[model samples]
Target chain A: MSTSPVTARLDRGVPRFGGFKLAIVRLEIRRQLRNRRTVFFTVAFPVFFFLIFGLNNAYASDPIGRGNESAFIMISMALYGTVLATSNGGATVSVERLSGWSRQLRITPLQPSAYIAIKMATSLVLGLVAILSVYIVAAFTHKPSMPLGLWFATGAAIWIGSLLFTAFGLFIGYLLPSENVMQLIGFALMLFSFGGGLFIPLSQFSHPLRVLATYTPLYGLNQLVHYPLVQGSFNWSWLSNLVSWLIIFTVGATWRFKRDTARV
Target chain B: MAERDVVPRTPPALELKGVRKDFGDVHAVRGIDLRIEPGEIVAFLGPNGAGKTTTIDMMLGLSVPSAGTVSVYGRTPLDAVRLGLVSAVMQSGGLLKDLTVAETVEYTAHLFTGARPVDEVMERAGISLIADRLVAKCSGGEQQRLRFAMALLPDPDLLLLDEPTQGMDVEGRRAFWKAIRHDAQAGRTIVFATHYLDEADAYADRVVLIREGEIVADGSAAEVKALASGRAVRATLFGADQATLRALPGVDHVEVHANSILLHCADSDAVARYLLTQTNAKDIEITARALEDAFVALTGSHARDESVQSNADEVLR
Candidate 1:
């Protein structure tokens, strides 16, 4: 019961992110890919939606910015896809947590910070696949047009933006019961998609509804990602909204995780 | 004496001082004190709901103690875990059904700083043959072995196994113990919980019996067996004399029922030998004291309720 040895060990600080953490993230991604059903639905559904909604002659003709209406819709669909995929990716933790796998991990030397990093990294990979699949389909169908740099930015923005929902997914996984978490995550993401003006344009909504959309979790990320295609003025409030929600979600997930492990 | 000042001696592998755990109204563990040295195979022998799992959980830092302290080596249980000095094979449900056995081991290896090679642990755990199979496709026994393989990845100093051979077949159980015994010979500490008396008696260097949230007995297997020492030798000897049966060495009591006689003694083997050789005894039956008797001996009595006794039934089985 001496404190000296502990202090000595503490002097040799353990790295939070290293080969071990990356290895877990890599393995997690591989495991997610092996679930063919989830892969097929998350990757294919968004592309399928983009084709159905954005491939019309009218959408291709109406110019919104440097691209056309089809380009704007394509970006929207990509954001929607990545949100679903990333949330689903993080939501799978609910099952893992319940299955005693988390309990198994509890006894190991893996630090809690490394675990969160692994989850976020793996979920971002899933989000990348989703958004890329949508973009590929859109390009193949000649549904959207933008500068080459904007296309890169659009994909990067949506992929990075998906981290918010990934943290939300992890939060929900630790908070909600595993059985209904997936269905619940899917439904909640759909509402966020609509409220954030991904499915319907915020410009068309009444001023009151538009103002309310600013407070929705997805609204900031949604508008900011569109800037790559729509080419609009930078809105500082958008960044603030996204950053605040991300902190809220990330903190919530960590809190729930600590609480879960304490009593588990 | 001069050398002792220059170098610190190793601490006990595990030390618990008045550890207690409570789940609201349920006192899962109540003030257990135990010290295990390195390389000792100690079995936490108990029936269901006897606080075996609760104590193990606290040892692994999976749950905090309601009171008291658990030290592994020289630090707290959680510190021991963080230092990668301890590992455990949990009772159940710590596997991903989708991952193959090999992937499971490999994935877990990534959590430790200098974990043993995946193939080495898998082969040592006797799970190499089923490495390619998905965990979902494995039998209960195979899954348990997979868990063992994962636990071995860290090459921990103290290994805790909770109901390790619960679902294993005879062959799997044999292989599991073979691996465990080999590790024991290598000077690693091991603590396992098992309801099977033979597992504790045959494998553990020491047996710590828990019942109704308390340590009822703690000693060598033979010493604990001595606590409930009497056995019976019953045989049909055709008009056996009660006076002759009572005169046998180690015989504590003798009961004659017409043509048959029952000898209750500390040594049943000698009594049986006498019945088979010295007398015309047929259909001889020698029975050792049951685990239930050991429980009764340690605790003075057992549960009167049918439900609680059913848990004891599992111990007998």
Candidate 2:
């Protein structure tokens, strides 16, 4: 019942990115890259879409603000690739949980928060790589034209946003059955992209649908990333929607992660 | 009562006080109070749903006990784990199939702040030869060794293994235990759960036999066996009278078959001594009951006793 001796033997307090935290992140990154099918799909899927649309001469010449419609299309494709890579990275925990690796981890010194941080870092690294792959492909084609500043901003926005959504991916991973999690996440990705007006402009949608699109999880992200390219009116609502979803995803993920480790 | 109440200066390696777990209306662990000192190897012998795993879960901090406390070196289970004082090799399914054996060890090692050298632990677990093989491609025994390698990373003060030798062939099992024996010699605290009583008898210094969420007996291997039932003394003795044998000290039952007699008795030594001096008994064999026999006698129904024929053996020849 005495507290002093027990606390004395304790290894002090946990530090953020202390000890083997960075090492774990590096390992996760390696694991993510080793998943060849996911890597192929994540880069190839968006790159394939960009090739079909961004390379078209008609779309190339069509300018809106600082760039042509093709530039906008490239940004969208880059965002898709980034999200695909990161979400896949996060959702891989479903397999880890099902395989009892998470349970295995429970016996180790790795704190769950440190573990979540490691996972996000690894996913975001892939997200960064995915953005560059599409951008690199777009650059070689010399078809998409945008301001240099917009290019960096949009890519950063997309990459950072993907970090937030890893929480959502992790939440889904813990909540859903591991067997069909990847497929369900894939379907969810498609639904979110379309609903958030990533594939098509919200202006192209019917009146009610455009309003509904504004409320979707990806809509705020889509708008935030494309804001520099379009130079449209900045809506405060967009930032709020994004922040709200971040809060939701973070809360849901940590809750689910804790529940499994603290079973009845 | 657990030894924790003795108020020793140095806390015991593991202390459980009336620890119980409940899954809704079902009580998985009714109550358990156990204390294990450092450097002792203990085995939890139990049936399928006898709450061994549940107790282990509570000890690993994988689940909270519905009541009471479980501490390692006086700290909480989670705290003990987070301090890298404890590690486990579970029964199965902790390996990533896609990862090569080395990668699996390296990845697991990265989770611990002060993990021992990956190569060293791999060699210790006798898994260095197959380091490049993917876990999915490895045989069942190989994968289990890989898990052992991972568990060894932190050089934990206490090691808990749940059915560590389950699914292993006899040769593989012996090899695995050889690795464990090397660790046991280093004065590490080890607690393992297993239905394989031979494993318990051979490896554990002390056995805590559990059944239906209760500890039926907690003692040394021989003491637990003695606690369950008496040993049997069999020999060839012509003209042995059943009534006279029953009258002998420590002899409970006497059965004569032609020129042979088998005495079921509490004290095999006393019965054997009397048979040698008084009767014309030869080929004298005092067979102590196997832990498997004691396990069956302690847990579950008598029906399953016949199924463990392979476990029977003669002792004290």
Instruction: Indicate which candidate wins on TM-score.
Output: 2
| Residue clash pairs of candidate 2 | none
| Best model number under lDDT | 2
What are the candidates' C-alpha RMSDs? 8.7, 7.5
Off by over 4 Å in 2: A1-20, B1-8, B231-248, B251-294, B297-317
Best by DockQ: 2
TM-score of each: 0.81, 0.83
> What is the total number of backbone clashes in candidate 2?
0
When summed lDDT is taken over every stretch of 10 residues in candidate 2 chain A, the lowest stretch is A7-16
**Model 2, range B44-102, lDDT digits (tens) per residue?**
98877889999998998888899999998888888788777888989999778878899
Could you tell me how far off, in angstroms, the CA of residue B192 lies in candidate 2 after the best superposition? 1.3
The number of residue pairs in model 1 that clash at the backbone is 0
Model 1 segments beyond 4 Å from truth? A1-20, A203-214, A232-237, B1-7, B229-317
For candidate 1, give the lDDT of residue B209. 86
User: lDDT per residue, candidate 1, B21-131, as tens digits?
Assistant: 989898899899999987788999888788999999989888889888888877788778876788898989989988899989988888777778999988888889989
